[model samples]
Target chain A: MNSTAVTGHEAATHESEPGFYGTSWQKLMMWWFIIGDAILFGSFLAAYGFSRISAVNWPDRTQMFSLNFITVMTFTLITSSATMATAVAASRRGDRKAAFNFTMATAVGGLAFLGMQAYEWYHLIHNGARMDTNPWGAPAFGAYFFAITGFHGSHVASGVLILLITAWNAKRGKSGPEGVELTGLYWHFVDLVWVFVFGCFYLI
Target chain B: MSDTHAAHVEASYRSYWIAWAILLVLTLVMISISTKAFLIGGILLKSVIIGAWFMHLKHERAILIWSVVAGILFAGFLFLVIHFDAGTSLL
Candidate 1:
């Protein structure tokens, strides 16, 4: 890692003067953001779990959540993470066009995931699910469900916009490789958080 | 200045594909474990895959990686402290 920011040419070298604990300042900041975000998501999940484990008669997941829809959404997000990872690798390899394309595909994946979420939400709302209400007698169920998934959906929305911007800059050759890489990190963190959310909310 | 990653991480599209495949398999395992005790295990496996491969945390600086570990611990701490306030199933 050189003191200079990574450019298209330097990205090919894959050599680094680890700026801050093996990454650039921007990259470090992204990780810090993720850490903070993780804490918040963690607390919400914990609250949901506590509500769940203590239930006398909880609505079973099969009845409350649409497994097929959520499973597809999970795949879409995971595929996006793969694309984001590929984009980072491409940028590191100095293939800006390939990197830009991969990132674009990642943004598409985010859009696809959001589309699925919207469809699911519309269907659930039609079935009488709301922030504070649900068909299930346990009103707390709807509250936590929407709270957790809604929060996650918001992150995915932000991620899509960030990816779009990163993709646009990569196309224009305006953003440095480090910038692309940091954005990629943020994208993956969103997916990472969703992993647990899926497990806690949908599976278990 | 020290690079946290091995100079030769062999970062490539091939690796990304491999990670994606692993994730899909883990998802399958998780969904199947849906109501089982291993559901939590499946979740942890998925997270490890994403953090190590997708986030490239495996090649990141020790401090960065440890920061993630610290974050997980902090989350665990949060749960432990908050569980008392949540309702109980004990009859």
Candidate 2:
């Protein structure tokens, strides 16, 4: 998985080398990084799951959350994942304009999602929900809620920055197809992670 | 880079839109499907579409796909292990 493996394609130098495996080394590394991230988030969610199930007085998340807004945020992320797909696809076809446009749309979607998260957090905090304290059934309720969601949100924030930078590179014609695809993979992973987080915190 | 690259570079735009619509519908259905089976089904559908198609894992090398599968399996194992001792004191 070293950078040296990609000598076949001229584009490999700037974007990534095609590795021992069929995929690019950088792309493979991104996949591995995401797998690690999945484990981290999975552990947190698992802990939260057990904690809530074991606790006698776990608060009802459905009632605690204003579902409409958070639902909007989730949809925004879903949209971003789709746009990211198109961006990578367009980049692969050498459609620079379309790739840049779709990538920008994805970044904007990420930003909108963050804005919604911030709004949700502000009201949740103002309403006396804290990682340390809440009138809810157990302190663990507030604790895991913020901890897990914040961890996921931070990923989204960074993902948005990544998309912005990637989009900028694409606009400048400096990004390779592999680079765009790798960025899309990261973005979609973020969206997929949110699915579980949403299920655990809201639907469950 | 090769003739078999298939969708390595371009994908069906319509499929992406269809996947997005499916996700939106599933989210709406989330409110009604709290049962364990439905929950698992929803997650599976969402995960497959996003991972297999949206993320283009379907065309990736076996090493990458298997590693990700291993990661998910391990995560599931974690859930199982924690479920057995879910409420044990964290501190």
Candidate 3:
């Protein structure tokens, strides 16, 4: 056999093979996960679109939702995504301190977003929004609003927890640059989903 | 690290901030414009910026990039079909 040829024993001993996508396995797996999550969000938003189109008395989104508040939420998420990118970059450059700090900042941004979303939900529920019915023109409006935004909010909550853990591990040198990069990928994906949600549900 | 590498890192950092600025500007423009077409376009642009810069999809291989793009296109196809069906059913 050629020297470069892998024997069964050598292949068995190998821990990792080369990534098929020219990236690390961790990153490739993260991308696949993000794609799957994207489809989930896409399906939710598509259903929302169908409901809105079919409803005869769809509530006026402009009246129901505060655009200014949504803008702030958008700003928070986008800023957090920027911080996450910085954290990934810092980790790549071996600046663990910067990575930890930026990851913490991202977590803070996510918390702030969740807090604001909670307030929005509180206000809506107080104003008579429920799963089966709502003060809005169409009952499906409340259901879709709750389902889509609540699912996205849950993701933000999860991202915040992951960021906190990532920051802690990064500070102690437990997780490496790939971990931060993967977390950043998930965080950006959350922000991407919001971009579509904000447009389809709020603006359009 | 070499000076060239440091320069590249700095450039990458600069690109991230540039993308952030563009995203903010696009978002503000979207809020200002009430037109649906413009809003959809702005959202798409923002998604592109985030995917390319923050997620580093732009630096990835074409195969990886196409995989993502294909997923999004599939979602779009699904939406189109649902939208059409919903519209026709109501008519």
Candidate 4:
């Protein structure tokens, strides 16, 4: 019933070390990783922005992408992030059943998003999109699109795998609440990156 | 569980759903509008909501929050500087 004893990892950290900013070392390390990942995406987007501005005939996004379909993909990721948050909360409250269920739900959502992304890629490639060339206006368009979205998709794929493992561990009472929270952080970071990608690449 | 603790849990759950609703609304609005400025603003707002609410940054200490915010802003600044150079090179 100790409020500070929400997770085994956290309790252990509190007893031994004050911890940087009073957060578990594991959580702090995760944040650092997220920051580094953010920089990676930021650099990619920056390069994309340069290509967009420098290009004489940038491809028309409206013609290349189906806005409605992209919106659905966005919805899936956001909903999955919400479910991840719920899982973390449930785990913290000692409701392992709910936590496991929500974690599984989040993994399902991630799978759905990846499936949609694959379809989108297939649709584009079928229409002559490739790394070197495309039916689009700029040759760099194909390269940037593939690089950015492909990297993001890879992150989602890995996140789904991690979620499945987390759920399995939770069901077996092997992982603690901190594990759920850490995974949730990573999941939300993926969604966060998509917000930028959707806005910078698709909307704008 | 005590009544107060139960109520707290309920409120926390409700907040997550509320964040989700706001995110959906923002996405719809972003797509409906074609203005670049509005889209950028919407993306930034959505990022803040996701970080603060869903990621529980609001519950973290000031030092951690500032570290994250500062790190991202510095990266963005670096991007802008590099972009300016790229622009000049083309000119």
Candidate 5:
């Protein structure tokens, strides 16, 4: 931890200290924001649950979706989460190379998950279950589907971008603790959201 | 500050890998169970475990964890109350 703002110690400092958003604090705030946003997504999912109950002919999830592919995707994602955590741990230990490799591995995992999701979306769309089709009775189903998962996908894409930037900075020896930790926070949040999504949309 | 201290820091990271392994197994278990039955309660439990251990939420301030819990509970309560009305069915 750096020292608090003081008189004599401040004079010799050549570099400006980064603000909270500049590194760890910014990442902490992002986590807080994601938590709140997650609640909103949860509400949407809860509403979907409510709608599922209300529908007279609620489609069978097992019939409509396949668990095998998602199973592979799930494994890929969870493994990615592991790699990302390893990256964070390595960064904290100043093993920059390990951190970079793990971060890249995590990004590849994210890409794989997204690719699987894209395939799932294609499968769903091909079956005449367009976002507006409302294969179930509730029209809100499609709305929530696109809105929540789309929002999450956007976050995943952004996380990938950050992972790239972090790796770049690491190679340059310019990456700082806050930056690495903040990226870790974002990666964890993405995985957390998927846990709930898998439960709500695919499983339950 | 010293080489020995840095080594200690590195050693602490070992538990992180263990935590990650536990989470991977839990995720597989949850997906399997999700197919057999709609276990909302179980999902909640698994989430708590992962969040606390893998996500390091356990090391976070009590207030932060409580805030998240309260938010989820409030949302749950509101949904329940709204759906309790007669002729209302939450599918």
Candidate 6:
């Protein structure tokens, strides 16, 4: 398929648009990027798993993680994903205000998640479990803790920034499917990656 | 091509919302089961669902699919090579 045929809403003709699977070209590119990212992060988690298998002892996530706060944070993020999808739908219907509200809600969800993550880290570090401490007696555990979660957190921050920009542009009536869809793609990827991260780190 | 394409896009929007809701619920369930070995499986499975539905990977072009598969395979090769040689090779 010719990607050049895909275009944002304002393109001259829908047939000339480069979108695939009903999405804009930029959204497709973002998915391609996510696939590559999955590989990068997947390798890290695989290494962690291998190391954990080889190690004698591992810490309990139930003991290590504050589940109550994390649950709330997770709820916020899940809600954000819902809001983002709503925004996408609204944008398609030409409801700019609703779309902007949902995007802003998604951003707020991202920020709330980050704030909770910060609090979790503060408590965890204060309790002496760190990459150096190895309080759980598995150095790989500590390494994975800092590496995966830290990297995911950085992505969340950047995704929030992108959402903010998208919201602003949408409000100004200058937003294109390229930007909104790309942000949606990234936001969805972030949520997808978190599923694995949460499973490997917090849950499993 | 035009008429069929429009129909397909319309169908996709319906599926998209359904998929999104399924994903959201599944994610929460996976997280709720935190600390279970199944959590990892749940996440992996849920990711595929979201990728296919929300990210529309299932609808992506062949080039996109091949490139990602090739890249992951190459990275896996690198990992295997490094791990196999880590014992005897000097850093």
Question: What is the lDDT of every predicted structure here?
Answer: 0.79, 0.81, 0.84, 0.86, 0.67, 0.69
Better TM-score candidate (1, 2): 2
lDDT winner between candidates 2 and 6? 2
lDDT string, candidate 1, B1-91, tens digits? 1273334435456787898999998898777765555877787778888888878798788889999889987986887776776555322
Q: In model 3, which residue pairs have backbone atoms overlapping below 3 Å? A: none
Candidate 5: misplaced stretches above 4 Å? Answer: A1-24, A134-139, B1-12, B34-38, B85-91
Q: Model 1: how far is A2 from its true place, Å?
A: 23
Task: Give the interface RMSD of each candidate.
Answer: 2.2, 2.2, 1.1, 1.6, 4.0, 4.9
Return the candidate ranking by DockQ, descending.
3, 4, 2, 1, 5, 6
DockQ category of candidate 3: medium
- Tens-digit lDDT track for model 5 on B12-89? 477667766676677677766654344576567666765675566766667667766787677567568656542454
Give the Cα error of residue A47 in candidate 5, in Å: 1.8
lDDT rank, highest first?
A: 4, 3, 2, 1, 6, 5
DockQ of 3: 0.74
Chain A TM-scores, per candidate, are 0.89, 0.91, 0.91, 0.92, 0.83, 0.88
The weakest ten consecutive residues by lDDT in model 4 chain B span: B82-91
Candidate 3: residue A187 lDDT (0-100): 90
How good is model 6 by TM-score?
A: 0.78
DockQ of each: 0.59, 0.60, 0.74, 0.64, 0.41, 0.27
Residue A106 lDDT (model 3)? 99
Accuracy of chain B in candidate 1 (TM-score): 0.73
Q: Model 2 off-target regions past 4 Å?
A: A1-20, B4-11, B87-91
CAPRI tier of model 2: medium
Q: Compared with the real two-chain complex, what DockQ does model 2 have?
A: 0.60
Could you tell me how far off, in angstroms, the CA of residue A123 lies in candidate 1 after the best superposition? 1.0
Put down candidate 5 lDDT per residue, A28-135, tens digits, no spaces: 465667677777767876676677666666667686678878768777877777787777667667788987898899889988888888898788777767566656
Please give, for residues A19-123, the per-residue lDDT of candidate 4 as tens digits: 768677667777888998998898888889888877888999998999999999999999999999999889877899999999999999999999999999999
> Tens-digit lDDT track for model 3 on B1-91?
3467677677889899889999998888888888877887788888899999899898788999999999887887778887876764422
Shift of residue A108 alpha carbon in model 3, Å: 0.2
